[model samples]
Target: MSIEVGSKVQGKVTGITNFGAFVELPEGSTGLVHISEVADNYVKDINEHLKVGDQVEVKVINVEKDGKIGLSIKKAKETQQPQRPRHNGPRNNRNDQRNQNKTESFEQKMNRFLKDSEDRLSSLKRNTESKRGGRGARRG
Candidate 1:
């Protein structure tokens, strides 16, 4: 069958290589299943996942100018759009964890405090030392 982008189709695995697999669809049209499109899980070896003559469902992700289709097995099985898990009832541990994480780490706070204190102390020492008439050169 002619495949279009975003359309899911059934195919038989015709060949497998290090890079991807070739699948022949109903109308004898062939498409490349890139290694990345083989599954939802990582596919380290394509042979382990598919063999010649195996039936598989794949989604057509692209159709090249030459009419060759780029297929994705992972996409064909994707029926539901992922939904953010719902939070029911009142917020609790999450907020507490957020509050705890909101504060600067102890080391950061201490470093900031030490830097400010050093600047203030240095300014104070300079002021006191300047009052001792140390600005200009003394009489030779």
Candidate 2:
């Protein structure tokens, strides 16, 4: 059977490695399910998740020109939760615009940054001069 990108297919795990697991697709074809693509969460060990001869359903993410196939187990499974609707009507947009208006403009932000830096530098210089009390003075 010919495998196409974005197609969900069942395959058998033929081999396991540190990086990923090798799966045998239909018609004697094989693909690599990368460690990241194995699950939705962090996958520390491939052996813990898959073993030799285990059947898994994977989504064909990419088919390289060199005949290498990329598969994703996470994408194959559908999410159980219903999606939330977006609240982006005119009323919500007015609130967003009000929030944006509260932010400082480029020149205003630069002036604030310069003033803070000048204060910090003056304070540092005073502290340094007070601590030195005469750089080359003899301790005696």
Candidate 3:
């Protein structure tokens, strides 16, 4: 029951901690299934996915020189699903939107810029005045 990187092995969950689940491998060696490696989705708690004595199939992702074995339950399951090919449809639409944005009239862009600047300056003035006791009423 030799465990090597990239190999899948069946193990029993020996312990569950806040950070990860410890699994006892077939050869009596234990490996850590970090919280991130427990699932494809966000796992706030490892206990939600595994418990002590539960059987799990984990993939050996790393074998550290200090004898630490890193495992991933997610990677073992991911092997069953085929990756989808990326499509260019949404990317082409984004390019079209960029071109449309570039076509805005100079006057329209200038107006928008002026409005944004005015809003920012007013906000800055309000913040500064509040801290300075309305600008004129200074503390003794």
Compute each candidate's TM-score over C-alphas: 0.57, 0.58, 0.61
lDDT of 1 by residue, 10-122 (tens): 89999999999999987889999999998776789999999999999888999999888899987887764564444553465555545676687888767867997999898
The whole-model lDDT of each prediction reads: 0.84, 0.85, 0.88
Kindly give the stretch of ten consecutive residues in candidate 1 with the minimal lDDT sum: 83-92
Say which candidate scores most in TM-score: 3
Cα error, residue 47 of model 2, in Å, equals 1.2
TM-score of model number 1: 0.57
Tens digit of lDDT per residue, candidate 2, span 59-93?
Answer: 89999999999998888874433445446577767
- Give candidate 3's TM-score: 0.61
Once fitted onto the true fold, the runs of candidate 3 whose alpha carbons sit more than 4 angstroms away are 83-140
- Which clashing pairs does model 2 show? none
Task: Rank all candidate structures by their TM-score, best first, as comma-separated numbers.
Answer: 3, 2, 1
lDDT by residue for model 3 over 1-140, one digit each (tens)? Answer: 68899999999999998999999998689999999999877899787889899999999999999999999999999888975544457776756656788978889878877997999899999889978798655688
Output the lDDT of residue 120, model 2.
86
Lowest lDDT block of 10, candidate 2: 78-87
